[model samples]
Target: MDDQNKNLILATVLSFLVVMVWFWLFPPEEPELTDLPPVAEAADVTTPSVAAETTSTPTTTPAASETVAEAARIAIETPEFKGSLSLQGARIDDLSLTQYREELADGSPIVHLLKPVGEAEAYFATFGWASAEGIAADQVPGPDTIWSVESGDALTPETPVTLVWDNGAGHIFRTEISVDEDFMFDYVQSVENTGTSNITLRPYGLLRRHGTPADLKNFFILHEGLVRMTDGELEETDYKKIVDYDLDPREGTQAVRLEATENGWIGYTDHYWMTTLIPEQGTAFRSTSKYFDSRDLYQAEAVMALQTVAPGETTEVTTRLYAGAKEWDAIRNYENEEGVTGFLDSIDWGWFFFLTKPIFWLLHNLNVIIGNMGWSIIALTFILKALVLPLAYKSYVSMAKMKELQPEMEALKEKSGEDKQALQQGMMKLYKDNKVNPAAGCMPILLQIPIFFSLYKVIFVTIELRHAPWIGWIKDLSAPDPSSIINLFGLLPWSAPEPGSFIALIAIGIMPIVLGVSMWLQQKLNPAPTDPTQKMIFAYMPWVFMFMLGGFASGLVLYWITNNVITFIQQYTIMRSHGSKPDLFGNITSSFKKAPPAKDAPAKPKNK
Candidate 1:
């Protein structure tokens, strides 16, 4: 193979291998079948007997049924969220985000963040006290215990609600639930020991989901299960992992527990939403994630240190619940301002977090300034191109010099004849004499691979890109192009095949076609290879890339198209400056014409 063909093949193979390895390492996760035991009612499990230290066997606790006809509920209303808190367990369930929806189209339902218990696929958060010595199990308030409203008529950002329950023994339990304008909910639980000598109890917060969400994307790029930040370390566990864990006899479930002394939070994170328990800062707590086989329930808990309340003394504990869409700014604020350690990491930044984070930050700020995510992506591509221009200029200059030396190189090959070593040495000497680096041509391609992967990660994983729109039929930048060549871009009555399907791979969309065209135009700056194998590989590479990236997020495809166009402009300009004016038009026209064969070395076969 010729030198150009060899370098081309090497670059193509390396790029393809990197992409394949990335997908193999982080392939789409398949939903595993779980044989969950039947769900037991709250009445079926025996309440733990009161102990001196409040250390009771951690058994499966059924959530209070929302379907109960007479169960009272406290209404929750915020600028960004709306839901009802079940009075039976005071669980912050039945929540929905006002800012987002199930679909981008009008009339689509708001994104429901939590569902009440007893509903299929029920998910919710609950807070209560675990019983201690001198405190009956019933006195601590079980999941099914009803409480009466003591203060507010309705719960809102400005008005908080207080619920009160009495244990007949003169121990009064009061829960004051407060909400901010956003998703955070403050639950302050206090106990007044009027008749008891002393009582010890542990305040615990639990978030439970009965089954996997029906709309889980299951894509490896996004995490849609358990996420926690413990003492400056972040952990993410999938539902399958929690379900497959070995049964813990003490918890009577499959669970993982961590002890955090400084700051921590635990919750279930969906693609764009999350429900987490944020313990008070500087408080030591036991963070536990459990999957109960009996109820098919996945639960995360923050059980705070035990507290003792003496007679006529009131003891209180405060915890926070976050339930809403995972807005980038909101989560970052909570991390920086509210002291939720590593809260921003709750968004699955993946292994390329360093690149993805900064890239997304720039893209996000640009979007804010431009007021359009698609334009923001285009702007980001331009900024990145400018940043790498110096390196790209050097590389392109080297390639132009190489092109200028083509005739000399051909002459050297002829002089050296079949001596491969002499030919290589000659080429190296020529390169050194010209102060050119043959390897310099590979730098741009190598740098782009990681940047492309990082951008893909950001577009796929960040909620900010979800449902972001560009012009004309491109409503969701995070998703593949909806218009497909198979359907003639909606001209035909049929729809395109589903993304990731074999058919969709071949029946790519307009963006990928444009991507291929941009790459093809870029290739036209140089002449097609003379060797047949080299010609064939170069001919198919652009379209191969087109099909390969056809199913990627539109935002990423947009970036690729933009990059190709900018690179073409930069290369053409630089090559012209180097006095090696690329015959782009001539090369493109010549590509359609048959090439004349090389001139023979004057009649060598006339000996006869």
Candidate 2:
């Protein structure tokens, strides 16, 4: 009996323990989560290939000048001011690719990479306030800024992009640009190995800004900073803004010096979803040097080779750039482009290109019909709840039957006395005969968990929810609840904590209360256990849960509350159909209409 009791207690405890851990893992992952995401350290041992990469410096040119000159006559032509432009065989004059200013929030600048024939005296350089951030490209008129590649072999501007190799055939690279129905342009660039020898090319998509080497190398600049390191898998960091993150001296097997005389910073940003930039701080500017560790994502070694490529062979690589803000309509349209959507890595959108993405598409479609994130969330939740209603119904039936049999169960327990096995066996027989399944309630709740997590993921990481507004004090459902008491003098305002978002602060506070109340109500529907100690320990579950989720997102808490309320309604409906009072813990006597036991049957025993 003691062993049986111990086993039952252990099972119950283990169930709760496993769920608690699972719940812990469900919340959004960001720098501020209660627990930091685990970081894996690089192994102490080094590989020969990694050693070779560390020692080998791939051929590099002095980075292109950020300054473009107005020396060309067409430089005076006014650039049409609007959203974005599409070009095909259009002659670009005094072309430049750079940020409008040193700030990340500055509007993305317009870039022109092609030019008309005879436009450059070699090249024209300059800058302008492309986005009104008090920054512009400029011309470096001195000899120091220009580089004339002396091709031992003759080459022309119409050279259909060729690869020149020593022992192997070289590689041919091509750059192409396309626009969608919404006029969002995607620049797809590919470098293919056309060489006879196989080669491993260290591919880096580079953008150069015109500024003094001092400014370029020392001052922290650009956007898309921070590399999100995943478990065991490698993803490159967003951007690196070190004063001298670039290699020097052309090519060799040595680490190149990339620092400027003055303090400056550089950046490496890919599209909008991921970026790594270093901020300027103190004498040391913001630097994300760790993001460029090539070994982290691909091969653990760094070698840019156009290795032995068999004749007529090609290795192509392409990347997409999302050059705008989090405008949902624009973004969704942009995502439709082939091979362009993968850049939206901010959301762990499923890789199938179909499964995970449909969630967003469905949400967006519903938005056109409903027009608000709050309403959208509510609608989505209700629909999901409806889909799972059968499970809840099953659980309700189980609960109702269990309530009906409580008295008989208690009577059996007393008759069995200290013989717990006999009591359990008898109870099992009764349950089997009556078609009652104890695990029904548990199974339904467990099934709901994954959906709950998926929704939570959608709410937290989807850029569509960035500043989405809800009703009243719940301005941004994605951030936090803004509903709070306006105590201006308080240390932490219900809405904010000084430097934090007011909406996020309030939302965090409300979650626990909402989740706790629902849990309490659900637990209350079940009778107090016959064991005094068991009842005592379980009584505090509500308050404990309330405290546990105090910092969770208000949206997640809202989902929990809605789920419980729906379950309660379903349970009540099921009970009333059987003519029993669902509010009452058990209707054992009422269900049987107080019938007396037969002579051959054992008499009911008294309670402990």
Candidate 3:
């Protein structure tokens, strides 16, 4: 085969392998149709901390669920959040993002980020003092301690709330909480000592989950577990990994702890949402990820160094909690404007951070300008194509030159039959004489692999694309196209088969069909290979991809379709410019014509 065909085969097989592996590793799950409870009945958000203790590892048992049920909750209302803070531990437990819903349905419940105790898979955040050298664990207010509202009745951006508890041991603990209009919660935890002796206490903030999130995607492509930044380094721990850690004898739980000097945050990151405990910047602290196997509880904690409190002295520590949608702009602001170091990395940019970051940045800005994610993706495709146009131009030009020299190369091949070395040397000389680089054509295809993977990461992991609408029938770009061929693109009365099912695997949607057609058209830009193997692979490649990618997010399929169409146009225009006009219609027509039966193999089988 000539270099052009070889390059095509390499690219085709590489892409096929990638998609096949992707299908095996993380097949899309069909979205459930049941409705989640409304905001009033939905009672959870991010994780609430496990009980505090004297040692670094938590030793105190969680208060009964009744404590959360009976504790008076302070109403938490903000522009982006709607929930309540439980007084039991001064935890911001029952919270939901007012801006997003659990599903695309009209009355779907809002996306609750944290849930109070007594709710299934309770998730919430709380900031409190862990006694290190203080009198006793009970001397400080703990999970069971009930705090009365010391100030504001409702927690709002305009009105901050304060909760106080007098330990009756000559010390009083107070937690003052405030929120921004966005998703961050600022807590100032303080303790005042009226006793004569000095006492040591370490202020800690934690996010505790009763179990793995019920809605966990559990996909390898997107992380949905403990994500923490210690010092400048980031670490992500899967639920299973956390469970597998060596047991901490003090707490009888698996725990991973690191001393974070300078800065850090610890939290659980879902696909599109996160709840993190961001200690005040410039502070030295300990970041911990712990899993209690018996309880199936996961806790992410940031505990500050112990400080001594003398008579009449007061100690205060500030920690921030981020619990809500992981909006790129908002998270970026938190890092750039709010001084959270390396906070932007929390978005799970994948190993291709170099490409994913810029791709997402361009896509996000394009979305802002165009006011539609679908068009933004198309615009992004154009922008990326333009960025790589120089390389693509060269590749196309080289392919066109190779095509022009095909007849002579074929004659050379026939003359050099059975002399492989001569054929190789002759082909090299021919390419060199024409100043054509065979390898140049593969560069763009190779470059596209990382870019394609990165864009996939951006669309799958980022909140901006969640439920983002493109056009009719593409309501959620993050989801597979709902208009299946079985339903006649929604024209038929019967419902389409559920995605991820065997039936839906074959009965794909309109977008994927369009995708397959676009690829086929792109292929028609060049004549089908004379070799039967190459011809069959090329012919089947587009349809194979269509089915494999049928269950992918509509946004990704849209990107692929746009990419294929743009590539066809670029190759066609470049070939025309290079004095080689592609007979697109003729090649497409010939593809359907019956091939002259394979010359009967010259009767070699009979002779054998």
What TM-score do all the candidates reach, one by one?
0.89, 0.54, 0.89
How far is each candidate from the true structure, as Cα RMSD in Å?
A: 5.2, 14.1, 6.3
For all candidates, the clash counts are: 0, 52, 12
lDDT against true structure, model 1: 0.79
User: Compared with the true structure, what per-residue lDDT tens digits does model 2 show for residues 1-608?
Assistant: 12244346537655765766465455323332132121111211111121132332222222222222211121211121122111211112233333222222336444333222222211111110000111111211111122221121211112211121121224443333333333122323333544454443322222222211111111111123322212212233322333224532332211222322222222232222221111111222111132123312111111121222344665433322222233445544433543222234433442332433665667777778999877776676677778777767777777666666666666766777888678777777766766777656555556675666666666655656655666655555655443333443233634344324434334345545667777777766554455556666667767665644444455666666777777666777776665556554433233434334323227655334
lDDT of 1 by residue, 1-608 (tens): 24764677557765785876477356666655553333434633333322544244743345544435358788888899777888877877788888898987799999887876556677778888887667766678756678889999889999999999998997999999999887789999898999848888788888878878877777766777889988888888887788898876656667788889888899999888889999998989888888767667777888888888899999999999988888889889988998888888988888989999899899989999999999999999999999999888888887777665555566666767888777777777777667778778777887897899899888888889999999898999988888899999999999889777778878989999999999988877643453456668887878878877888889999999999999999988887776665776552111121212123312112112
Q: What is the TM-score (0 to 1) of candidate 3?
A: 0.89
**Model 3 clash tally?**
12
Quantify all predictions' global Cα lDDT against the true fold: 0.79, 0.40, 0.79
- Of the candidates numbered 1 and 2, which has the greater TM-score value? 1
Model 1 ranges off by over 4 Å: 1-56, 59-69, 410-419, 491-501, 526-535, 585-608
> Residue 252 in model 1: shift from native, Å?
2.5
